[model samples]
Target: MVGERSKQAFERAKRVLVGGVNSPVRAFRAVGGTPYFADRGEGPYLYDIDGHRYIDYLMSWGPLIWGHAHPDIVRAIAETAARGTSFGVPTELETEMAEEIVELVPSVEKVRMVSSGTEATMSAIRLARAATGRTAIVKCIGCYHGHADSFLVKAGSGVAALGLPDSPGVPQSVAERTLTVPYNDADAMEKLFADRGDEIAAVILEPVAGNMGCVLPLPGYLEAVREITRRYGSLLIFDEVITGFRVGLGGAQARFGVLPDLTTFGKVIGAGLPVGAYGGRKDLMALVAPEGPVYQAGTLSGNPLAMAAGLTSLRMLKRAATEGAYDRLESYGRRLVEAFCQTASHCGLPATGHAIGGMFGLFFHSGPIVDFETAKACDQALYADFFHEMLAEGVAFAPAQLESGFMSMVHGEAEIEKTIEAMERAIPRIAARRR
Candidate 1:
């Protein structure tokens, strides 16, 4: 059913919006088609402008952990909106959110809200520079923090999909302060510290690299990073924007049992609303105004509607954690990935996949995708074919090979079974096209 209507809308959008999309990934360039214009999402399904209903796996790019348009979150937003929207001043809901985050996340002793993931990371880096009185930051090559000037160099996700190692508009002087190293390489990290340990202000990374197709860190990689950062008096930042509550109530830091000095969060925390947060030790956080010299502020940082939605989502996640939601997620992920692997193998196509919690990735023509380079080497054309086939069969996936897919609490036995069926039907068509 995704036919003329969606295509017409995209054609019109092209005249007004650059690439016919606000975000680069939404244009469906990797999949070689016009992107479906979503009308609305309910439960586990997305309804497109062309009247097609698809069992969604992208989950709005990793938010909506409870699924789209959950009653609780919607109701909370409605009730909060009736009171007031933004005050440009503190509210009780803001304090409650901060308390909830600090209590749940292992590394967050005090938290500050921001309007988006970009602001959270942008402010966190500034705070690190102020605390350490150093200018340099060490970031992993494939991990994406945000669109900040420093993070745009060798970023992953949409940037990687475009095959641009770095973006323009970033001055060489600003980019030089950011040192890039490969993920899961502890020896390289050690060498960097040995050479410029004193000049480095912080080391920031996605503990679980979701930007590069859900690649997990190797054994002892996080522990090694923690040790190195501590040895050199550099702050360690875990960018949990995608992994925060989606992985577990305590996030990847607690799941892996390696705590960082600071943590940045988005996605699940907002429950599909626009929000982000950064927090850390009390001493370091206090340095942000009006307590100390490091100044960071946002007018809409703690908007009431966003706070209500976030609070509801966090409460649901807490309840789910108590009721073994993570266990359910693991079971569902395993079933879907196993089914896809079996189908791909039967078609004589090399494939490997991995999943944890509610996030998963399927790499085409892969041995093992452990790092960004290995992840990028995946057969993108085959992935595009599979994506189109799956869409035709009423299953939605992340359009780009480098982006990971997400499952929500609503993705139960029925939806997972249906997705596996769709994959089985789609994989052979993709393989036949390759032949």
Candidate 2:
């Protein structure tokens, strides 16, 4: 329950914080209630400031794969912090971190570290343009690649969650360079490339679209896009900020056996710290500064603390992967999806969901929800009702219908069972309310 203290805190926050929250979705406008301010988190659980404990599926919006405050990760951050927070000088830790990524992800032979996913993505596109000598870039219609000006046009997630069509400051001229095609539509991608092939520098997409509600790629969709880009002399860039390590020991590319020319990463790599990276073929990444002509630099690009935390998380995942951890995570997610769909069916409410690796989505639509156009048709009001009712039953999902729900490695049978029961209890309340 949102207690008096949390309500008061939100009231006070409104006096200063924009929309009473740092992030728009955190304001809870989509879900229609006051958002709970997090006090702290433990394995698979988050405690709000009002002394409420709920099984957490948000996982800090897809970063906490190890769950909150794992001892190894905590120790790594602490030890690195004690040595000195940030040093302008280079450190071997950065080299080791880069090496780990190069070794684990199949397509990345070189990397440029940045502080956030937006930086990584924007930097990658700049490199893509410089390499290809083309000014135009193409992105999937509703796949978000962070908040860079080029990405603002037809973006998803937070932009969708808050009901903002598109950000105001992105110039129409910039938007003109970005071509949009519906996700999972191979023919649309092919037509777009054929029509504008010479003008396009790159085509960027999420291998598994995380933004528009965890939608999966259709059969051969990624392969088709890869072929189309290659045929047109445009680069293929996968924005794996949410799916990177969360999807597998390698990312979606390695799992699906389809490689992109470039990849962007954040979330899991940072292990709940502020970090992001973009890496690719040696020749392309070689175009980045100090190594080549294109210039992009960040003073805190490879901060030791973030490197330590991320490196530790990656190492732990490498070990756990051999132990069948990824399979376990996928199984747990499938169970939740099944339970959600089953209970909704029993209550005579339409519902559909998808789960893969550590990410899952719950929707108030009967789905074959492959693209944003289809995803948007879900019953928003029903989702909002289910969202609050589940909260009252002590389970926390994403505040918006369009966002993906994440599962962590630490979420085991107990948490899964509890969440499913909460779903069962919460579903009928939502259905009955409409009566």
Candidate 3:
């Protein structure tokens, strides 16, 4: 149950903030209950305003790869802030951040910094259109690139959670220019390309489909998309906002060995700061800004604080990668998946899950969830019960069933055990509800 303080805060927030939350999913609309207001976070734990402590797996929706309020990141932000926060002019830190991204990501030869994932993706689309001299962009049905007009056609996350068809504000002209295809269906993608290949400037998608619950690319699926895009003279854009550094140091393109023409990144890149980036082949990226006609600019595109914090985090991640930190995250995620599945079995409830790097997803449905169609078939009502139950037991997952869960480096065996124990209780309660 929500504490009185949180309830009062929410009521107060409703008077000022739209929907009583900045983000739609944070409103707890999908799961029936008052949203718990966060007071602070440390390592793997988040303290709600009501004074409840939770072993947090939300990880601020995948930005906190090192967990919340990491000392190093905090120190970096402090030091950078002491110097200055934002300058409309270029900074050395921005160049350093760009160099780091160029070195780590295989597809990004020249990168442009942005304020959020939406900005990164929207700019990438614009660059693709300019580079290819085409008008249409293809996106997977449930793979959310962002809230950009070109991306909201069949987006997931909050859009799916709210059961909205497509955002109303998006013009019909723009929506039509954005093609839609089912994720993990190579045949559908191939067919779509065959019919309208000439009109497409790019095909953008989440290489791992985190928005629709961490759906993995079907074997050879990414390779096929790459081949098709290359043959059709259309750019392939990988929306790695959620998967970038979270999956591996080099991101999904490196992990899958399938390079995209352009890649958009956020979350882990900023190390929990407000930042995003899009980069690609030098020639393609050269078309943006002063060098070319395709114009995109932001006053705080490479803000000092964001760059400093992200640079520190990336350096730490690079060092940890040398010692197999990503492997440990994967191991932790796998353990959670096992526990979730086993507990569901014990409770006599159908369930399915997948663990990839530090990201995972749980579905209140049977196995073989591949795309939006299958992901939507999950028992959301049952998941709500499980969500509330887990919250009561001091564990936190994403509030919506459609959202993916995250694991942070700070989470150890003890945290994992506590989460599993919470699941142990939560699953049985869900089963009881079903009975």
Candidate 4:
């Protein structure tokens, strides 16, 4: 049950905000309860309105690698704000942030900052089409690249959670220009390019799919896509909005040793601020203005506050990486996965999961949740029940099954242990209800 204050707050919000929230998934539609309003977050825990606390694995949808309101990040933002928020002209802080991205990401050489992930991806596709002289693009099914018109077809995340595969407002011709293929299926990708190779400006993907429940690429899947794109003279775009810096210091491309032509980043780079970026080979990025004609611009492209906070976060990550911090996050995620799997097994219910670096997924399916079709086949109702039970136990997973669960540097042994115990208690009750 939701606390009264949160319930009241939601009712008040519904009169003004769309669906009582800006985002659809926050309505808790999948879980069938009043969404708890967050009051404050500290370290690994989020305190909700009406005074409920949970060990938060949501991690603000994969940005808070150092955890909520981290002192360094907060101080950096405060110091930057004292100076100024935004300037119509350029700032050195933007350059510093771009330099860090270029250094850390495997594919990015020259980058352009934007206001949101949607902007980063939308601009990347536009540049790709201009460079290739083609208007068509390919995107992995269930791999969301923000809410761009070209990406709304067969998208995931909130769109999928809301059960709207393709939104209404996007035109039919626009949707048709965006081709789709099942993720982790190189053969499907090869086939698509074989038929429409000349038309495809680029193939955009989440190298490690986050929106479709943290799905990992099949072995050699990324490599095959890279080869196909190279042979066809098409660019490969890795949508690393979730995986960048969260999966590793250099991201999934570094982890898997496959480099795309262009990469888009958001969540971790801004450290939870509303920021995004797209970068690629110098020659390609050279085509973007004021260097060339394919124009995309934002007044808040490099807001100083975002730059300062992100710079501080990335710098801290660089130090933490030296201390094997990413490995620790992976280990912690694996423990939660193990606990969830073990309890489901004890209850004779189907369960499977995967954890990589700082991201994990819990599925109410037996095994091998490779793509959207398989992921959707999982027992969603059962997941909804389990979700609420865990919430009651003070462990907050993503509100829906298709979204990824995030781990943070702040979540330690104690939090992990308590979460495991919570799962142990919650799953059995859910199982009993099913029986």
Clashes of each: 0, 0, 0, 0
State the weakest 10-residue window (summed lDDT) of model 3.
425-434
Question: How far does residue 251 in candidate 3 sit from its true spot (Å)?
Answer: 0.2
Residues 45-116 of candidate 3 have per-residue lDDT tens digits of: 999999999999999999999999999999999998998888789999999999999999988899999999
- Candidate 2, residues 198-296: lDDT per residue as tens digits? 999999999999998999999999999999999889999999999998889889999898999999999998899999999999999989989899999
Model 2: number of backbone collisions: 0
Report the error of model 1 at residue 17, Å. Answer: 1.2
Candidate 4 accuracy as lDDT: 0.93
What lDDT does the true structure give each of the candidates?
0.91, 0.92, 0.92, 0.93
lDDT for position 55 in model 1:
98
Q: Rank the candidates by lDDT, best first.
A: 4, 2, 3, 1
Model 4, runs deviating above 4 Å: none
Q: Provide the global lDDT of candidate 1 against the true structure.
A: 0.91
Error of 3 at 101 (Å): 0.7
Superposed by TM-score, candidate 1 places the C-alpha of residue 384 at a distance from the truth, in angstroms, of 0.5
Model 2 gets an lDDT of 0.92
Candidate 1 vs candidate 2: which has greater lDDT? 2
Instruction: Candidate 1: give the clashing pairs.
Output: none
Give model 3 RMSD, 1 decimal: 0.8
Error of 4 at 426 (Å): 0.3
- Off-target runs (Cα >4 Å) in candidate 3 are none
